[model samples]
Target: MENSRFWRDPAVPFIEARDVLDGRHVCYARHSHESFSIGAIVSGHSTYLNGRARHRVGQGTVVVMNPGDVHACNPLQDQPWAYRMLYLDTPWLTELQHQMGLGAHQDLRTFATTHSDDPRLFAGLNGLYATLTNADLAPLAKHSATIEFFTLAQQCLDPLPQRAVLAHDKLGRAADFIRANCTGEVTLAEICSVAQLSPSYLIRAFKQQYGLTPHGYLTDCRIQFARAQLRRGRAIAEAALDAGFADQAHLQRVFKQHLAATPGHYRAHSSIR
Candidate 1:
């Protein structure tokens, strides 16, 4: 795990991420993912092969591979290399295209940019990787940040940009529903129905419009609910359960993740003030 690391969260299922800190010994046979793949060379050099084309890539180079596109990267001359990559589920990305008004029919389309050295793109990809890997961030922030990054990737990497759909405020219902039921399990289906919005639309645009995903908003609601319980001198375990977390530990983890403080610390401090 020292040289290679992978990050995934069920909360954000549309994407998977991985990185290689030292790829000199790492090698891949011609391979493909059913998902859309994009990556950046963080440091070092390697030979990139896509279809019949081969190119020498170095730091700052960004590469892309569509679903089923056989490609591989290997170190050149046994030299040290490093990289970070993201694999995005095709359906999720295509639906995002539809939300962006890329086509009348929501369907996946191929992008032509095989590779580039755009500094902005390189920095964006790296930033996204960092954000996704940070465990302390809330799930809503993770998912929303993902959508924002991928949206940027599409418009900036594609040779032709699509016309963006006009903004809409239909997400309020979804937010309200989430707030109303913050202490309970809520599905994407439930939110979509309430908001009269597609999953992709809600996923990508909700944070843009409201500054938080329904899940993030729900988490905040739960935290606030727990805070109220704690103010009444209730037990932390009881507060967590009432707030819809599995148990005190679960709530403690999420509480620390969002607030960077333990429930005990918050509870003890609140009593003094």
Candidate 2:
């Protein structure tokens, strides 16, 4: 279909992914899968039903389905929506759980959470999707990222009986991390690791302390970087790429959102003597 895209590689056989840019017309009946499934709502809203539970999921919502869980999601009132889904082989994921020392080795680790809106978790999933689909990146990088993201998924989404206490002791360190990596690929896991904060704790407190979510702050940093470049009369597309935006249009959308002016307008005015 015109709205669908899929990414899978022979080197990474355990994972397969698909993203639907406009899924309002797409419909599905209640069904179960043999593999574990995780998905994020990229935009718009939908009604999500997993077994007896039902919830409305919007942008940034991450939904998890265990193997054989009957579930279905459809657009809310025919509204347009976009989403990304990743399915992992059950045995491979169960082995990963055992390797992570999450719990008993006998079964797939059940995620008590059917869904989450945690910004860190949401951003991590998007970042992972981007990485997994990248053609230039090495297979080893994709493999490492898959492991890192699922590990964080477990930490953020599953019920843990005895986890070590974590604190927001390094907000400055966190900001510095974002600033340093504004022009490169960065992950929520790295921010949590460098700041010594848990994923669940990092996003909310970072927003409270910095007045922006970690992803938001990163965008702001990139905007600032691009703005500085525009002041020097650099081209919009070049500035966008150097600032780590996906492309010029991405920079344009966000630049306008943050500055309330187009990049071209800003650059034209800034070049005045």
Q: Itemize residue pairs with steric clashes in candidate 1.
A: none
Candidate 1 lDDT over residue span 1-273, tens digit each:
455555666677677777778877567655445678999999999999886679999999999887645567888999998998888988898888888777647457667677889888889899988888887888799788888988888777872344333267577677678878988899999999988999998988876654456676677678768865765669999999999989999888777654334677656643110
Candidate 1 residue spans exceeding 4 A from truth: 159-273
> How accurate locally, in lDDT, is each candidate?
0.76, 0.79
User: lDDT tens digits, residues 1-273, model 2?
Assistant: 346555667688788777778767567655445578899999999999886789999999999987645577888999999998888888888788889886655677677688999988999999999998887889999999999998898888874443222244597789889988989988999999999999988898887665567887788788878976885679999999999999999999888665445788767642111
Residue-level lDDT for 71 in candidate 2: 70
- Candidate 2 CA-lDDT value: 0.79
Each candidate structure's TM-score, on Cα atoms with residue i matched to residue i, is 0.58, 0.58
How far off is residue 76 in model 1, in Å? 0.5
lDDT of 1 at 240: 100
At residue 125, what lDDT does model 2 achieve?
92
